[model samples]
Target: MHTIASWRRLLAEFLGTALLVTAVVGSGIMASRLSPNDVGLQLLENSVATAFALSALILTFGPISGAHFNPVVSAADWFLGRRTGTGLPGRDLAGYAAAQTTGAIAGSVLANLMFDLAPVTFASKERSAGNLWLGEIVATAGLLLLIFALGRSGRAAVAPAAVGAYIGAAYWFTSSTSFANPAVTIGRAFTDTFAGIAPASVPGFVIAQLAGLLIGVGLLLAFYPDAGRSADDIVVAHPIDQAAHRP
Candidate 1:
């Protein structure tokens, strides 16, 4: 594969993550408006929009950055591929995380402004509960498991649709609606709309996501001991070279 420039990959990550959060927060706000009295209907609308948008974004940006809009996904790619020298390096991981996080916040603010709301109103939806935390753990772990497993099995081509479907299903199956990405969790804290999480709830959610990351690593290793061999392919394969992978 031809090597892509580091700047291009970083730009892809930034833009991809921003658009994803935009779809999520914007759809949530629209759903609430369209179904003011029907919470179930609103959730359905939100989840469907999120699922479709996620798949499309992955397809759009996967070639440039592997479409890893989530911090945990990027971190897992680094950790799993560290020993094999095939996954993202520490520096690029940091860059990806920073870009993804900032993009998420920007996306949240954009969503708010598009809806005639404040640019950075701190969210007020408190989601600090034991069950919700557990849900995050489950959701995050399952997501990583699916992503790495597909790469390991040479089935990465379906990752975009599969990941989207998993997240959409998780919205109903998990108590916390599957805020599996740390960057996204932080961004959602910036808005008080239907898709937002309380700023106070951010720490707990982040902790749970980290815990989920560890569990996901464990599960991936257990199921596919050599999964690290495909680390560079996590989420999806791109054309990043070792030089671009470096910090």
Candidate 2:
């Protein structure tokens, strides 16, 4: 039985993820449609637009939902003590994965119609095997670390921008095209837009992202020491610092 707040948080996740996939997949579809000479300029345009839209979207919905949009991120948050209440145990991730998959499919369906997307195509499989796996690892790790730094430090106010900026940057630098998001990647499978990953590849991507998340968790413990976790968090910092410096 979920408390009211927890249920709201869950619904928020659903809504936020749907919106996120819409922007990402929709942009991909539109870009591909404009050019028939392969994914040349289209991919470049797709990358830039996606980075901006995703950054804004996360910023908009992050506060209300933590804007997870990906299961691995939530798991890391759980371990970091940022997420409360019960989470799906390891064996029960199927239910959570199902929820994410369903949400992603619904989102992609809506975007397809809204953008008038064309028939799906498995074109330009841009990533290499080694690069693909490594991209997932680094991308997820970057996103988690960015989230944890801003969130756990009580600086959650800037979380949306911080998260968005990170994804945007990863898009440019990361080889696997930053499929840091498990939900978005799954949602993308149903569409043959500029943004889609081959449906067959989803499982491998998820595994890599999860491994990256675990590695991030390990690093988080080392980077952010517990002994220094102050009560001032954000809540207690503001007025105290003002008072301390007061003459």
Candidate 3:
């Protein structure tokens, strides 16, 4: 288990989230420009870049903060932790969420600057639709399921590849292109690029994601009732105490 300081954990979350969003928005912009006439190509490029970046980031920071770059993931961790007294406390959960939100915004601004776009433009691309909302629900539920299931089972060592692979696959399968993360959804809104979601569309997407989270949790508890019984019970090990176990 990690015994790192609180400040360091928060820093890891912030930096990791920022970099993830940066890759998301930056790649979207580049893909759009490079394949202006091919929407499929644009999505292909963006999804590939995001998958690779996310895998690398998770592996790099998982030992420090569990690499929870999304609010839903943090919240889920806190919820599950409460069950066995091994997850984050309320205060830490709030901190992680706040840091993720802030980092996401900063990452969007950074992506804009990198692409020579306005640093604070609000996205105008509206992505509201019943089908898309359903996609969000499916996307987020699958994500949480994968995460907690990996923890419940004894396969956390494969999380980086597994999670990244799932996200990559979800990108192609979901109608909303799987903006399964609330923070990333918000961050993408800061840029009016191909990957951007209009600010107006943010609330609905977030709600759907949350709803999905709840369903995922319910499913996890039902299927893996003994999962996450304690920090030690987790096979993969959350970053909460990964450092403590390090040699």
Candidate 4:
């Protein structure tokens, strides 16, 4: 693969992240306004739609951008030895986070304006602590493990689909509906849109995700000795995590 510049990668990151968050938040707003009773089904619908769209977009753009789209996922990728170049540069990581964050904010804000779902300062809100914590742990662990398993298997080629699939399932499996990315979590805070987490609650979710991702990446590495090595050094494809092999 020809090495694309940081600028191109950043553009891809911004657009991809924006698209994912917009669809999620936008769908949420629509669902809420449409029917309170169908909200449960709406959540599932939005998650699946987002996941499938993300999978396709990521696959289409992964070659140019690494398709991180999420700051938490990018940080995990950093620890797991995945990057276009050595580390994608510390500066680039900061840029990617900034772009992802900005895009998510724009996504939420746009959705709010489009749908009239702006959050009022005085509005009573629920952030769901117990469910959110469980979500953070489950979402983070699943994301990191998917990356690890895919990468070690030499399936970096299919990261988009694998990642999207993991996320799609996470919404169903976890509570709090899986705010898997810090950027998305923060972005969603500005809106009362669908899938939005209260601004006051963002910190806990981020901490949980970071902790889970860090530990999960390490655990993922231990699944295979050679698998942990740089992709340049490995030849095998699609190695499964031994942890996943356990009952």
Candidate 5:
């Protein structure tokens, strides 16, 4: 059994994802304000802030919840570890996803409030395009690959920095700006800001991300057949609380 309570883990996921989104949306707002005309500079600032915040959040919460702020990451962990019983259990999947999504939306609202905008303004930025979908697939696939590979190789210690670096780089390289997370996409739709996405564009991005999850699984299996052995350590290693299972 696990060494941490389920509620604690869920809370960590919620707060971590919320804070991460706050960093994303908040930084985007600040970047836009700081460099009103330079889209390039704005992106750079936003990406850098996100990357740093993600890494720090991981470090802060990794030991408690594994710091999986993304639904895809949690799903990947469950899928890859199902057979071995080392990763997230089936029962907790829905809870994790729900918590992450809700927290994400809350974070976006908080960012809007911080910036003196309406609390729940829906985004109007349309991001529909074949290339953007392709970018989501590629970005999500690469992320899963990197995360699982680290677990398999026992390099999870550097996951914070490495994952951050990968995402920072992907923000520049990917066409979709590396929105490889469904919950984050949903949250971004809550605000019409520099980091927001149109609600209409959300479904497509989510579908692409899910597809990327599948592709990532296939790649992980092919390259690291024994990845399941380290499934419990994906992103970071955390002990599961066994008290609930004990008599």
Candidate 6:
């Protein structure tokens, strides 16, 4: 029921997400190794690497897969597309989610292997406090609001940089370190490192993120009701295509 184009998009999502997670997990390991005595310095190094890597990955793959790499973002796209008919089809949305999750897991495994660690160990870092859940909700909501707001204001072309910057800022601002993406959260659970989340904690984090997604949708509907008026200019479309069409 899917076309070749859809498959290509899914593949891009897979690769992008995998790379994103690789950057996250790999940087966390490297930071821990490099800054063994200073938690603050380790965080700084990890955040910077992740931000830069994220921007690069988004720019590289946005044309092919919309650079979603996040289940919440894909779900939001599906929800908007349902109303405007310019979004991805339900089947394709599902494919995107599956690919993102698979890629995230693969990325974690690869990162662990690259570091000579066990490939399938569960994370032991407990992060399920109420404050952390609130932070996740806040982080996810802000991310979605920023993304869809750009789509509404016709500035989505800067999403790669803007989103990466927001995440980097959130790393310091949010209490839970802003695991706003569910796929990334799951992937982090596979690694028992500085960035890892315990398996028992992932459900709470994911639920908070979904709740945040709903809040983001509500905000988008209230403020940018016409963002999806043009399907091609919506949240995850190719930036190059957006540039070519400008008058």
Could you tally the backbone clashes for each prediction? 1, 0, 6, 4, 7, 0
CA lDDT of each prediction against the hidden true structure: 0.92, 0.64, 0.85, 0.70, 0.94, 0.86
lDDT of 2: 0.64
Query: Model 6 has how many clashing residue pairs?
Result: 0
1-247, model 4: which lDDT tens digit per residue?
A: 2245667778878887888878887777676666668867788778777788878877666666667778876665554454444334455668889989988887777777777655332112467586678778878877877776776676776777777788888888887677778998888887765577777788888888887777777777678544445432111122233454567
Sort the predicted structures by TM-score, highest score first. Answer: 5, 1, 3, 6, 4, 2
Question: Candidate 6 regions off by >4 Å?
Answer: 1-4, 234-236, 239-247
Candidate 3 lDDT tens digits, 117-209: 889889999999989999999999999889888877767888888888888899999998998989889888999998899999999999999
Lowest summed lDDT across 10 adjacent residues in model 2 is found at 231-240
- In candidate 4, which residue ranges exceed 4 Å CA deviation? 82-87, 116-124, 226-247
RMSD of each: 2.9, 7.3, 2.5, 8.1, 1.7, 3.8
Candidate 5 per-residue C-alpha lDDT over 141-243 given as tens digits, one digit per residue, 9 for 90 to 100: 9999999999999999999999999999999999999999999999999999999999999999999999999999999999988788898887889965656
Clashing pairs in 5: 2-240, 2-241, 2-242, 3-240, 3-241, 4-240, 4-241
Candidate 3 residues lying further than 4 Å off, grouped into runs, are 230-247
Q: Which number leads on lDDT? A: 5
What's the C-alpha lDDT at position 30 in model 6?
A: 98
Model 1: per-residue lDDT, tens digit, 95-153? Answer: 99999999999999999999999899899988999999999999999999999999999
Error of 6 at 92 (Å): 0.9
Q: Flag clash pairs in model 1.
A: 91-247
In angstroms, the error of model 1 at 205 is 0.1
Each prediction's TM-score versus the true structure = 0.95, 0.77, 0.93, 0.83, 0.97, 0.93
Task: Select the stronger candidate by TM-score from 2 and 3.
Answer: 3
Which run of 10 residues does model 5 get worst, by summed lDDT?
238-247
lDDT of 5 at 42: 99
Clashes, model 5 = 7
